[model samples]
Target chain A: MLKATVYVTLRESVLDPQGHAIQGALHSLGFDEVKGVRIGKYLEVNVDTTDKAQAEERVREMCEKLLANTVIEDYRFEILEG
Target chain B: MRVAVIQFPGSNADVDMYQAVEDIMGAPVDYVWHSHNDLSAYDIILLPGGFSYGDYLRCGAVARFSPVMEQVIKAAEEGKLILGVCNGFQILTEAGLLPGALLRNASLKFLCKLSELRVVNNSTAFTQDYSQDEVIQIPIAHGEGNYFCDEETLAKLQANNQIVFCYENENPNGSINGIAGIINERGNVLGMMPHPERAVHAWMTSDDGKRMFTSILKTWREKNGVTTNA
Candidate 1:
């Protein structure tokens, strides 16, 4: 079995109001070193396939079809074997 | 005209849309389940506002894959009139029936209040009753209503006159160019965050939305060659 860890983040062009709010809160908390904060989604999927190539293909398709909206979000995934 | 108000599992505004079409507009309307596969019987499709699928992943993300959305896409291709309000608008964008996506409000809060909007284009089937630049009040209720699109798409929308409504003065959600509503290139499909149906009655707040339903009826009548003196 293989596990795919996916991370989805808003594209650079799109504004992240939640992230901005978080940055503000951090500033109030005296985290002066924090220049920016962007929020995103993380998902971990366990693929039943043993073939690494097939797992990668399936995970990519999942991200494109349902997990991530490519219009405003960019996604990357890493596969782990157990 | 026959209207279908689509009802997804988490949809809360389906009855509002149904009443708007049936009681207010005096048109025949029905509620269609999300699992329904056919939409050919309905002349107008209305997607109402609500947290479809509990708004789990993203607003309208999971609901976009509902079985009925395929028919919605097909109906759009056939030039059927479609109106998506709030969550419906989000679903339309996720379904690719409309361009761009709606993000969280800039304030990061759910906004529920009347918003002033200017009619940008009155030539389309949805807004012919309103004069160009006419300002009307419609209530918006959503946490994710900020509209965003790439610059190239914005240019095309501007050039094509697909922008149907713009926020009059105060940009509530910080949408791109204060876009309140937009129509598809074919002019048959419209998506707006504001709930025109909720504003149809005087008691509810504003009656300015009455003309929008009338405009749709008028356009449909003109296309079908039905003469109505009312």
Candidate 2:
């Protein structure tokens, strides 16, 4: 089995209010070094296949179609073997 | 006039839409489940406001894949009038039936109030009853009502006069150009963030929404060469 870990984040141009609010909270907690934060989504999908190449392709398609909205966000994924 | 109000799992406004069309407009309307994929029987297709599928995986992403959406897309392409309100607007954007996507409100809070909207374009089938630049009041309830699109798309929308609604003075959700609603290139599909369905009755809200529904009926009437009883 191949496990795909996907990370989706808002594009840099877009402002993330949730992330900004969290950053404010972090600063209030005295984490001054953390100057910025952007919230994102993480997802994992396991493919029942032994071919790494095909698994990667499928993962990309999943990310483009459902996992990430390319219009406002960017996504990256890495595969792990069972 | 026969209309179809699509109901997804988390849809809470289908009943309101039904009442707006059936009780107020005195038209025949039916509820179509999200899992059903046929819309040929209806003249107007309405995607009402609600948090469909619990708003999972983005506002309207999951609901965009509902079985009924395929048929809705086909209907949109066939030049049938499609109206989407609030979450319905998000679904239309996600389904690629409309340009641009709704983003999180700049305030990051659920906004529920009466927002003054200007009729930017009155030439479309949905806004035919209203005069250009007329200001009207409509209720909006949403968390992600801010609209976004690329610069090119925005220019195209402006050039084509597809923008239908804009915030009056103050931009509530920080949408680009204060856009509250827009129509497709063919003027058949309209997606807006405000809840026009809730404004059909004067005892409830204002009756501004009535004209929007009438606009659709009039357009249909004209297309089919049907004369009104009056």
Candidate 3:
């Protein structure tokens, strides 16, 4: 078995409204100088494969197929031993 | 002009969008349930706006896991024209099909009103009918429509002309650079907060929205080189 962690984040050029809202809230609350903010998602998956290469392939497939969108988001995966 | 509108639970605008594309635009349109995975029959796949999955966890957070998205993503990669509007835009972002994320309104209020949007780029297959800097009126309804991105990425997008639409006159949600809509790198997928379907005809409001769908139809015809839409 293999454990994989996937990190997904919007591309640098894409806007992040959630982070902006948080910044606005901070400013409204008197926390000035909060330069910037951004948000992203993290996901972990467990694959029932022993071969590291196979598991890695599966993880990448998962990201491309569902876990991540190659268009506007970038995702990276890290594998863990069973 | 066969269009497929994917319907998810809690999607209120699915029927409206379907009618606009099918009945109003006079194209053959069908509603594909979110569970369906096959998209080979349709020329266009539209993810219409609405609060999908009740905007649980986050707007479009849960709906990103829908089964149909798998097929949509594949078809999009194959150069199919895919449009996501409003909540649809949020879902596209969450699914990673589009860039950026939709956060709460700058004022944290649910805003529903007609907005003026300027066409920033008319080079995409979806915006071929528009001219550069064309201003359009459409309705936007959502609590989260503010767009954000890093400075470097913003510059890249500007350089590449990926931004399709920017708010005019009023920046409703405080989007970065007043971005209201954007297209992907391949120019096949488009996501925007404004609802063109909501303003396709004069009776509905204005025909500015009709031009977008018409433009897509024109693009498909131009690419196929066959003008047979009977």
Candidate 4:
């Protein structure tokens, strides 16, 4: 099986209000040096195939189709096979 | 006009939408469950507010795949009127029936209150009862209502006069261009964050929302050769 981990974040050009609120909360809790933060989603999927190329392709299709909204988010994935 | 109000599992505004259409607008309405795929009989399709699928994955991400949404898409393509409010708006965007996405409010808090909206283009079916440039008040309740689109889409929207409502004086959710509501390029689909259904009663925020329903009825009547009561 191949395990894929995907990270999704707001596009750099877009503002992240949730991240901004978290930054404020972190600062209030004494993590004052934090300059910025952008909230996002992470997903892990296990594919049944061992073919590395096919698994990566399937993961990309998943991300494009449903895992992430490409309109406002940027997503990258890492795959591990066992 | 025959109106259909979709009832998703977690939808809390279905009653309000049904009441707004049947009682306030004097139109026949059908409460269609999300699983019902047939939607050919409805003249107007209303997607009401409230979280669907518990807002899992995304506000409307899961609901977008509902079997009924396929019929909704077909209706939109047939130029049938479709109105999506609050979570409904999110579903439409997620379904790609409308451009742009609704993000977390800029304040990072759920906003539930009355908001003033300026009618940007009253030529669409949803805004005919409202005058161009008129300011109206409606209640908005949602955690993710901040509308966003890329520059290309924004430019196209402005070029096509697709933006129907703009926040007046204050932008409560930080929507780009103060856009509170917009119609699709074909003008048959409208998605807005405000609760027009909730405003159908005088006891609610204001009667301004009733005008939207009236506008739809008026348009349908005109198209069907029935003289409008206006």
Of the candidates shown, which would achieve the greatest DockQ relative to the real structure?
1
What DockQ score does model 1 reach against the true complex?
0.85
Separate DockQ for every predicted complex: 0.85, 0.81, 0.15, 0.82
Error of 3 at B65 (Å): 1.1
Docking class of 3: incorrect
TM-score of chain B of each: 0.98, 0.98, 0.96, 0.98
- Model 1 root-mean-square deviation: 0.8
lDDT of candidate 3 vs native? 0.85
- The Cα error of candidate 4 at residue B6, in Å, is 0.8
Clashing pairs in 4: none
Cα lDDT tens digits for candidate 2, A1-82: 9999899999998788889999999999999999899999998898999999999999999999988888899999999996
CAPRI band of model 2? Answer: high
Interface root-mean-square deviation (Å) of every model: 0.6, 0.8, 5.0, 0.7
lDDT of 1 by residue, B14-68 (tens): 9988888876669888999999999999988999999999999899999999999
Clash pairs for candidate 3 = A13-B153, A13-B154, A14-B149, A15-B148, A15-B149, A16-B148
lDDT of 4: 0.92
Error of 3 at B109 (Å): 1.0
The best-first sequence of candidates by TM-score reads 1, 2, 4, 3
Worst 10 residues of 1 chain A by lDDT: A73-82
Error of 3 at B187 (Å): 0.6
Taking the tens digit of each residue's C-alpha lDDT, what string does model 4 give over A1-43?
A: 9899999899998999888888999999999999998889988
lDDT of each: 0.94, 0.92, 0.85, 0.92
